[model samples]
Target: MNAAANAPRKLPGPVRAVGRRLPRMPASIAFATALNLTLRRKFPADVLDRLEGHTFAIVVEDAGVELLFRVRARRFVPVAQAAEPVLRFRAVAWDYATLAAREADPDTLFFNRRLLVEGDTEIALLVKNTLDTIDIPRTRGILRRVLRAAAPGGG
Candidate 1:
């Protein structure tokens, strides 16, 4: 393993600023599309039914971005806003990446206050457990490559 890969990487301030200024709909759309493409088939029908009609928000603190979406027709749909979301996850972008990469455990992050979850605890656990059950092909490698490319002196 390369030393660069092991080093911590943070999004540049300018990049974060750009992320903050960017529109949410496009981001939400991309997020939903990726979710549908990668994890939709793995999700149980019962879980989908339970998730239906519930809004969710992911707040990226450092990026200053909030993605609002809901499960409708068994698909994730981006929404501009929601009065109240059934679940809200707040975390920095790197933390989210690490979580997705499985380099950092969600429980550790939550306990350390790096990842914050709000709203329905049961649903949150369901989501977490469901994610843990399925394996996404090349997730860690892909995320590592992406992070490496994004890092200042990396790649």
Candidate 2:
């Protein structure tokens, strides 16, 4: 394989700038909706209950976006910045994509400092362990699998 082909891709600066300016509500809504459709059923009800009223933030550094959400009524909902989040995850967009694609392990990323998880250690462990237990079905194409994993409601 060519070295260029193996190189990591980064989101363009202009695109990142646009991403930074994206309205938090809409982005959060989309993210929450995707999570609801894909991982909601996979998460145990008790876990959801435990997460209730707790806010979380995902900061995509390269994308220049911070998504804030809370679990309400056993569902994830977008929330405006009010108080400190119970947990905050920070990483570049490529790292996040690799995670979603299952091309990179979260534990490895965390240990390597490529992925940062802060605040409420117990809650962070709960979320991480919960996610580790999930098993998304494997599909033929990586992109297809990612898309299906993101929006499993279609299938």
Candidate 3:
């Protein structure tokens, strides 16, 4: 691989500059949308259908952002206010990424208290069990390919 390809990329000037002006809500919504889309593709529809009307929050501590999503309209949608989320999960950004990237296991993380979940235990268990069956790295790879193809010059 080229050394250029190995180097880390800084955010484009426009993105970094606009990042300040852009509100948090949209980014959260977009993230939830991407996750929902990926999950829908990877899992059975009935599984996600069960989430309808339920509210869940994923808090990325390092990013200083919490994404609250309500299952509605047959899809997960981000909401600015959820009086009380049925389930809330919190983890540092890198830790969460490692879990999602399959570099770390969820059970291991939970056992080590690296991943914390709050609220309805039964619901949390249900979500956790469902997620455990998923091949996160594979799903993430596919999502990345789709996104890159959609980006300028990615083809």
Task: Give per-residue CA lDDT, model 2, range 106-142, as digits (tens).
Answer: 8777767778998999989898889878877552146
TM-score, cand. 3: 0.70
**Which regions of candidate 3 are displaced past 4 Å?**
1-22, 136-155
Give the clashing residue pairs of candidate 3, or none.
none
On a 0 to 100 scale, what is the lDDT of residue 68 in model 3?
A: 80
Better of 1 and 2 by lDDT: 1
Kindly list the per-residue Cα lDDT of model 1 for residues 65-145, writing each as its tens digit.
898889998898888879999999998888788777766778877877778999999999999999888888587689878
Candidate 2 — which residues are off by over 4 angstroms? Answer: 1-9, 138-155
lDDT tens per residue, model 3, 1-155: 12112212233455544554556688778987887767756655776777779998887654556778887766778888778999999876556554565545676767667688989888787777777787767666764555445445777
- lDDT (CA) for every model shown? 0.83, 0.77, 0.68
User: C-alpha displacement of 82 in model 3, angstroms?
Assistant: 1.0
Query: How far is 37's C-alpha from truth in model 3 (Å)?
Result: 2.8
Of the candidates shown, which would achieve the greatest TM-score relative to the real structure? 1
Worst 10 residues of 1 by lDDT: 1-10
Model 1: lDDT equals: 0.83
lDDT of 2: 0.77
